[model samples]
Target chain A: MIPVDIPLWADLLASLLMITGGALTLIGSLGLLRLPDLFARIHGPTLNNSLGLGSVLLASILIASIQADRLVFQEVLITLFVVATAPVTAMLLMRAGMYRRRADGGKKKAPQPDEST
Target chain B: MTTLLPFAVSFALIAFALAMIFAGIRLLRGPAAEDRVLALDTLYVNSMITALTLGIQFGDRLYFDIALLIALFGFVGSAAMAKFLLRGEVIEP
Candidate 1:
């Protein structure tokens, strides 16, 4: 067994980061359950993608590097991908919901006529 | 260090999995298509986090790659679902 030792400070920080991130994710999930509408639910996952994932990735990078005595930058790539993709997906979902509501004749305020429309 | 890490990671992962299950239930129970879509989105995010936790547990770099791929594919699937909902069609051609 290769004896791997991480400094106490590093361990404490990493654990704190991971636990906080996990808690945030749990809260976001609870939001999904508690929110009353589709739009409201969308906000929950957005929080996870932005802050929850960000914190977790940071913790992973920090912990791995300290334990292995080498820098691990791969987590950065994942973080970048998640952040870039989340907003586009959310926007698409919102637009889709709006379109479907309109089609179903649900009670929604009418969009003002625009040259594009 | 080893013991503490394994316990922490496992606890966190379990919590996250429970959350995902709740979100899944919401998806199934949604009265509206858009509500289901939002629930599905939450499911994807939770699964991604679970994958990350697994990577930490096994100390393997490849798991990170898998998580990234999942994120990519998840984004595409979500986009397609949204598009289908929006236009009543997925493709124009």
Candidate 2:
């Protein structure tokens, strides 16, 4: 027993937002494939975390609130948490990568250990 | 509202799920540890979104709480992994 009578405007808006979120996520995945290096690939997932997740969360909130006939803010909390954490993780990972590269003597000017000691 | 809800939730879930799978691919194919870490972060984000969609679909407020917890844990795990990568140890003596 659910109402099948939704205004056309609501339906249109929800569908549009959902599609936008999906398209952004798909594009991010494609970017992940197209990017050249680890640093560059990180950018793609950032897009997914920010824009992709944001849109979907917004759409969920809108649809749920409209259907339930009451204000729901749960999705808001999730969105905030995701946005807050994604960048920190990305930054830490990048730093780690840099450190590992340096330790492995991948740097062009890294001095070699003395051969005759 | 129900009709529209299903379509919207399903579309969002499918898209985010696909993104997670794609990220998983990158994780498996990563040329370096950092790349894998990046993919893992993306996976966590998508999982949170998936949980939110489930909440909306099923009309359960509790799932949102689960999503929040997952987000928190994912953040801590990613931070630890990054720290390990940077210092070669997660804890210092």
Candidate 3:
């Protein structure tokens, strides 16, 4: 009963992509909640950063392009930004976490000077 | 397919809401400073996704700009916080 102007194929593809992307994002957040410890939880967001967001952006691109009858690819900018920045953020956070752990007297002892030499 | 799109979009929206809630819970309950920062990072990303989905739902180009802004600032915020955590200052002297 809904009045959709886009072609059925495009609608099907966009819906499929959106649904899949949403599911992946949900799973990523669930991982963030269920995983124990900061180190383990850090792995969770990466899931959404790559696969989940990528698919959703693809769906956005598809829907926009089909509706406008031209390739409206503005969403690609987001994909590019996320791809470029995700690893950097992950690395920075990991390094910071390590720094904090060390500052708090981490599990392993620091190496001592070679006194036997 | 016409009917399917609405259902699919709604599902996506609901999923995003749930995801945001989970991220918020993590942001609030995370024990360490780094954990809170990570949660904040996730929160922004989730918000960006919500904006993108809203764009899709409403067929608006404006939300794309919103999503882009969120992505840009989220990265900057997360990176600054991480740097502060590591060096005790966002900018080194």
lDDT of 2 by residue, A10-91 (tens): 6677677777777788778767778987666778877778877787777667767777888866777777777677788888
Fnat for the candidates in order: 0.52, 0.63, 0.73
What TM-scores result for chain A when each predicted structure is judged separately against the true chain A? 0.83, 0.81, 0.81
Query: What tens digits encode model 1's per-residue C-alpha lDDT throughout B1-56?
Result: 45355556766787788889878988999878877877887888889888887777
- On the 0 to 100 scale, the lDDT of residue B90 in model 1 is 78
List model 3 lDDT by residue over A7-100, tens digit each.
Answer: 7887888889889988988998988889987777889988889888988898889888877888999888998999999899888888777666
Whose TM-score is greatest here?
3
lDDT of 2 by residue, B1-93 (tens): 246656766777788778888888988998888888777877887787778667766767677788889889989998999888888888989
Q: Measured by C-alpha RMSD in angstroms, how accurate is candidate 3?
A: 3.9
Q: Write the residue-wise lDDT of candidate 3 on B1-93 in tens digits.
A: 235788888999999899989999988987898889998999899899989989988888899999999999999999999898988999887
Alpha-carbon lDDT, every model: 0.77, 0.74, 0.86
Cα-lDDT of candidate 2: 0.74
- Better candidate number, 1 or 2, judged by TM-score: 1
lDDT of 3: 0.86
State in Å the error of residue A68, model 3.
0.9
User: Given candidate 2, what's the lDDT at residue A63?
Assistant: 62
Residue pairs with backbone atoms closer than 3 Å in model 1 (clashes): none
Clashes of each: 0, 0, 0
TM-score of 1: 0.88
